[model samples]
Target: MPETLLVLLAGLAAGALNAVGGGGTFVALPALVAAGQSPVTANASSTIALVPGAVAGAWVYRRELAPVGPASTKSLTAVSVLGGGLGAALVLALPSESFDAAVPWLLAFATVLFAFGGRLSGALRGTLDRPLAPGPRTVLVMQFVLAVYGGYFGGGVGIMMLAVWSVGLGIDSATGNPMRIAQLAAIYVSATALFLAISDARSSPLVLTTMVAGAVAGGFGGAHLARRLPARLLRAVVLSTAVTMTVLYFLRG
Candidate 1:
């Protein structure tokens, strides 16, 4: 019961964080790990569990979605889907022992990316007075790579997407927000589909179902609250969570 409750709360916070910014994986992945799942299974399960929330967030921003530079929304989404599938396959192919050893370092890397993503985006944006105007190919390639990472271990994938768009396409975070959510949904959707088909995410049906329900509710509510809540407050809360979770994972290791 306690484990169930913990995951339920984690799902709520993870969904809210994803809706407000992009740190859902940081919350969901660790929670599943703590629930006694192996790192590989936890990662796959977390990805599956968070799919609904990302989709809900995407729906909320549907009308506002924009293309990344020269890439149309359809094109970007297609690349994200393909890349996500590949990443999921990679995860399933890895041995459990290898994945377990890598989890802590992955969490630390994600924490750093989440912590500095904004400032790094700003710095890169400042270097160019105008958007880099990378051709459609370059934009798609960058997105594909990020999508691969998103599928494999999503922790700060959203922030990385925003940063890439800001640097390569001269898109500001606000302007790119809708696209970020959309692409995240695309990646998660593809990844989850793959997970459900071949992974053991279904092993903990109760935990997964509870988290999904909470994520959906939280994602919807968070989308509405996003407009009212201060962005700094949201970012601070997520960063703290990410830091704490990363530390715990390292200690466990």
Candidate 2:
């Protein structure tokens, strides 16, 4: 089979997986590497290509954004955008081996969070409505750190954001999804911009274009399903996929 056709197929599969489960990188990354791109280049290309999908997914959930208090949204957005730039810079500066070695550990940590995240998030939801008024400083700090991680590596960030927003910031999952989507979109935009300005992204244009197209389609579908689907099943699927992909990443390493 032709490489272009193969990439487009992989992109389609990745889009569907990402929409449903948020592990699209697990598909696109390997496909890029197999097609002879270096791991670092593949990672950068994948991040760039995935941005449009994330945006589409976020737009699907845009209605959820309406109810969030403006102050909270503004605060999180600021931190996410700033942190994304820092993370992208770190990715550009890191040695390829170091980045590769870190991927497994990051994946493992995200998997663990997804596993226990439900109970934790449930406990915090009650507090979200009470107007406790915790300062934004801590949330900003955490967002910066997470955005850096997201921009640099780009897997499981959604789960991490869900946990943080639900548990740390005292937001319910339903409201948090839109906020998370916005934050992630900011991070992706910042990171992609930095990568294009300073890194070598020209090497994988074909792969990038096809993957983005697939992700955009899948994201729209996923968001639509997310609105209608039961939360329990969505959480279960997301957690299971994250764990399985983490294992795969470790084994591949």
Candidate 3:
């Protein structure tokens, strides 16, 4: 009962974080692994289950979705689906040992990325007289690579995308957020497709269902809460949770 409740709460928090900011994977992945799923399976399971939540966030921003630059929304979404599929395939092909070894470093990198993403964005904007957008081709290439990462580990991929847009084109985070949510949903769609088709993630039907239920609620409520709460406060709360969880995982290692 305790573990069940924890995973449910983790899903809620993770979904809320994904809605308001990003870094929900940091919560979802670790919580599942702690609940006794293998690293790879946990990742696969979490991706499969939380996909609907990503879609929900994307739906809320559907009308307001912004493009990265010269790259149209259709083009970016296409690349996301392709790259995410490739990433999901990679996870299935790679040995489990490799992911276990890399978990600590991945978590550390994600933690740092989430921590400094905004500062780095601010610095980039400050240094330039006017933020210039990256070429269309460049934006596409960057999105593909980030999509691969998002499909695989997906801890702070949203922050990475925001940074990519911020530096590549001086796009404001607020403006880029809807795009981030949309692209993320595309990636999750493909990744989840692969997980359900080939992975053992479905074996734990109870865990998957519970988390999915909680995530749906969180995603819906979070979308509404985002308008009411200050962005900084929401981010701080999510970041704090991510940092603490990352530290715990590293210490356990």
Candidate 4:
């Protein structure tokens, strides 16, 4: 089969998973690398390709987006945008070898978060839901840091954001979901912009076009399906998939 056909199929699968579960890069990145792209190139390509999917997913949850507090949204957006730019720059400037060693560790951490996500959410709810303490300034700081990580290598960013909001900010996962999507959209948008500014323009347009097509289709499907599925079940599916991918990354490493 032709390589382009293979990439397009992979993009479709990744987009579907991204819309529903997150960690689409676990599929897309390896596909790009196997297609003869360098790790750096593949990483950048995957990041760029995934932007439309993120945007599409965010749009599918547009109604929920309005309920997020404006002040928090603004703060998170600013930090995420700045951090994403910095992270994209670092990715472009640094040697790929530096990141190769770290990928497995990062994947493992993401896996642990996914595997224990429900219990962690429950614990946070028990401790933090009473009287609603003031949000932490430190959480805002951490948001920027996590945004940087997302920009540099965005496999399980959604899960990480959920953890930060639930554990650090004392926000419930259900309440924080829309805000997480918005903040991630900001991060990806900023990172995409930075990559366009710094990197060579070879092969990006083709990848972006096909990816966007798949993402829009999958986003609609995922969002529609989400409305039908029980929240607990949906969350479980995402958690399981994320954990499985993280374990695979560790083994591959």
The lDDT leader among the candidates is: 1
Clashing pairs in 2: none
lDDT of 3 by residue, 72-94 (tens): 99999999999898889988988
Model 4 error, position 100 (Å): 2.9
Candidate 1 vs candidate 4: the TM-score winner is: 4
85 Cα displacement, candidate 1 (Å): 0.7
**Model 1 lDDT, residue 158, Cα:** 76
Q: lDDT of all predictions, in order shown?
A: 0.80, 0.72, 0.78, 0.69
Ten consecutive residues with minimal summed lDDT in candidate 1? 229-238
Clashing pairs in 3: 133-169
Q: Write the per-residue lDDT of candidate 2 for residues 1-253, one digit (tens) a residue.
A: 4777766666766655665656777777787787778877777777777778778877877767842333467777777788888888887887667777777888787677657665665555556655433466766777788898888877777767766655554554455665666677788888989888877777667767877777677767777776676766777777787888889878988
Off by over 4 Å in 1: 96-131, 229-253
The true-structure Cα RMSD of candidate 2 reads 3.2
Worst 10 contiguous positions by lDDT, candidate 4: 65-74
| Candidate 1 all-Cα RMSD | 3.2
Off by over 4 Å in 4: 66-71, 117-136, 170-175
RMSD of each: 3.2, 3.2, 2.9, 2.9
Question: Where is model 2 poorest over a 10-residue stretch in terms of lDDT?
Answer: 63-72
What overall lDDT, based on C-alpha atoms, would model 3 receive against the true structure? 0.78
Off by over 4 Å in 2: 66-71, 118-134, 170-175
Clashes of each: 0, 0, 1, 0
Residues 1-253, candidate 4: write the lDDT tens digits. Answer: 3666666766776666666656677888887776667777777777777777667767877777632322466677889889888888888877767676687777667657655655676675678675333354566787888888888887777667765554444454445555666676788788888877777525556665665566556655665565565667766766787677777877887
